[model samples]
Target: MISKRKLYYLLSPSMRYSIRKIYYFPSDFWDLISGKRDKTIPPKGLIFIGPGDFKRIGEHYLNIFKEQCNLLPNHRVLDVGCGIGRIAIPLTNYLNKEGSYEGFDIVKNGIDWCQKNITQKNPNFKFTHIDLKNDLYNLKTEQTANNFVFPYQDSSFDLVVLTSVFTHMMPDDVVNYIKEINRVLKPNGKCLVTFFILNEESKNYMKSNSDFNFQYNFGDYSLMDKDVKEANIAFEEKFIFNCIKENNLTIEKTLYGFWSGRPKNESFDYQDTLILTK
Candidate 1:
């Protein structure tokens, strides 16, 4: 069987993008027609592949935060690129009344759903729609990624989490986000981010993997498909480490993931996770 990544390239870039949007149409239609789509449970078509994946990934992140970040019940949390409350739903039960949560994403539909569902009931959980331009997701925007300021006061959040976000972003944009994360983080605050780290080991592993390969080297990072650079971006490990430190965010720990073809026991998730503190 053809791998998903390989199959993704069979169509032109525009076609691929259109197909993805089209793929989600049925789920959106179901929500409109049946009213069966649970607001508590995000529609499976947007960020996740399966219905259970939303809870599964959210709980996994919660566990990681608790274990590595010492996440407390009263800690203020920020979910960057929070897609349809996949992570926020689980966090609602974990955070105490004193704690608050804020989430933002480039997609309007996800943000609208999250606002009506999550923030309406629990006012502490706020969601914002950032109309940032992205080839695959948001196509038009007045604000550029490097210049768009995070809509929060300085030193606001205790913990900031970004899952599967940087994997699709460019290096400069990622650095700008790191700087923003550093700026908004309270003293001793932690930021947990997931990335496709291109170290020597991972680089070698990708060479033999027919499913996905970071073939286009762009100095600081590599892309699986050159035509659609943002589809899957992987940064050089050293470059990312330096970028993080330069942004004043110290790397507390690095947990490698299974996307590099590492043995199941050796990897934690699909994307390598970095725990950072300012």
Candidate 2:
């Protein structure tokens, strides 16, 4: 049995978007009529990313940013792949007027919704849509991710965040993004990111978890679906470390998430996390 996500990748982006709307229409309508959905949260149909409760996940990361990343009220932050303002929504409450946020994503609708909903209220938060082509999430754009330059000055951000971003990117694209992240980060700045790391132990766990579709293995990385390489991927530990070392970034902390069928309480986050410093 394959995962629903793998099945989703078998279709085009427009078909996937339509299916999502059809699948969530009943629950979204019920939430709206019952008033159970929080006013601040986006409509269920609009939240394409994330696994669980959006606000809860956002708040959970906020705590980690404060305690682990040492994010300050005046820190300038950058959020790559800021889908539908899920992460940005929580930060609006935490970041004062002194702090600012800038986010960008490949999906135009997500960025459009975010701009209309989140940016109008909080002028400090901004979102942009980049036309990058990805097999899993995007195909309409002809722009390639490997050479795309980030629209920011050098040493611009205090904290850079990329949650579940690298897992969907190819190896070359990931390296370029890492270099771009290093370039945009101020000296002594930190970046928090999540990945599905393939190691000896994780390989053993993958045997037990059928939901994870990292079956097509390359030397350093594995793909969930060969047809859609960006649908899901797991990287080798050495490959990840080598990229970090070569990119002028130093590891500050590493926490392996329980994605490999380990006890949920044993992990810090759902995916393997790393905090790197420039």
Candidate 3:
């Protein structure tokens, strides 16, 4: 039996709707929070949550990730911070028998869930847990709990996708991950990263609303202008472009607002999808 405290914590109001929306299999409150569950599989080809309007959101992002990959039949792909095979599964289905896919994440439950629910009998799909604490990718010996390091050899993958992963990371963590991504990507390899950025449009939206007290950061994650108390510490276009330039990478293509629902403005949108290459 699960404890009431644990159950309540797992099903917090903020996450309850999202969890209930996605999971259909038997996931107790404990299982939801602990991310472990007994074996009782859903039918094959059936999305556990069933196809609905919400699934379209996932599909839209999947399409964006695929467009960024522009994958060849023989290309090897990497899905970093792959959450419960959301993107990884679709990418595998897209590749079919043509290409290979490897996904990595720090959370064991997510990998376990993917292994049981998403991994097909197909030999092309592989999933692994990356431990930054162990310096898995030979990343600097100083390992922090927040860092995620990939364990693949240099130039192993043709394409890497980090959809929505950097949105939750701090600025320092994003920079470290970018360096690690550059290390693993083959020469001429491409990467696509998504971010929740503060743009001129978002700033104006906040400013126009007298009730909303939000401010925008001026091209720096560390500093925020007055009235902006909480800014999403992800990448701004300028910051990301500078990082790419510093790393000697070329901007292959940049697609903005493809999946983000932010309102348009004179300067920018609230979200951006960037595609970079070396």
Among the numbered candidates, top TM-score falls to: 2
Residue 89 CA error for candidate 2 (Å)? 0.4
The models' CA-based lDDT, in order, is: 0.83, 0.90, 0.59
- What TM value does model 1 have? 0.88
Could you estimate the TM-score for every candidate? 0.88, 0.96, 0.66
- By lDDT, the best candidate is 2
Residues 1-278, model 1: lDDT tens digits: 86676676556634653575689888778886898776577555554222346677788889989999999999999999887888898899999999999999887778888888788888989999988876456656656687778999999999999988898788878989999999999999999999999888887787678676787888899988776677788999999999999988899999999887876699987889999999
* Cα deviation of 72, candidate 2, in Å: 0.9
* Model 2: ten consecutive residues of lowest lDDT: 1-10
Comparing 2 and 3 by lDDT, which wins?
Answer: 2
Candidate 3 per-residue lDDT, tens place, 5-66, comes to 33533443325334544564344545656756433332222222223343345566567656
The order by descending lDDT is: 2, 1, 3
Clashes found in each candidate (C-alpha, N, C closer than 3 A): 0, 0, 1
Name model 3 segments beyond 4 Å from true. 1-55, 96-98, 131-148, 208-219, 222-232, 258-270
Candidate 1 clashing pairs, residues 3+ apart or interchain: none
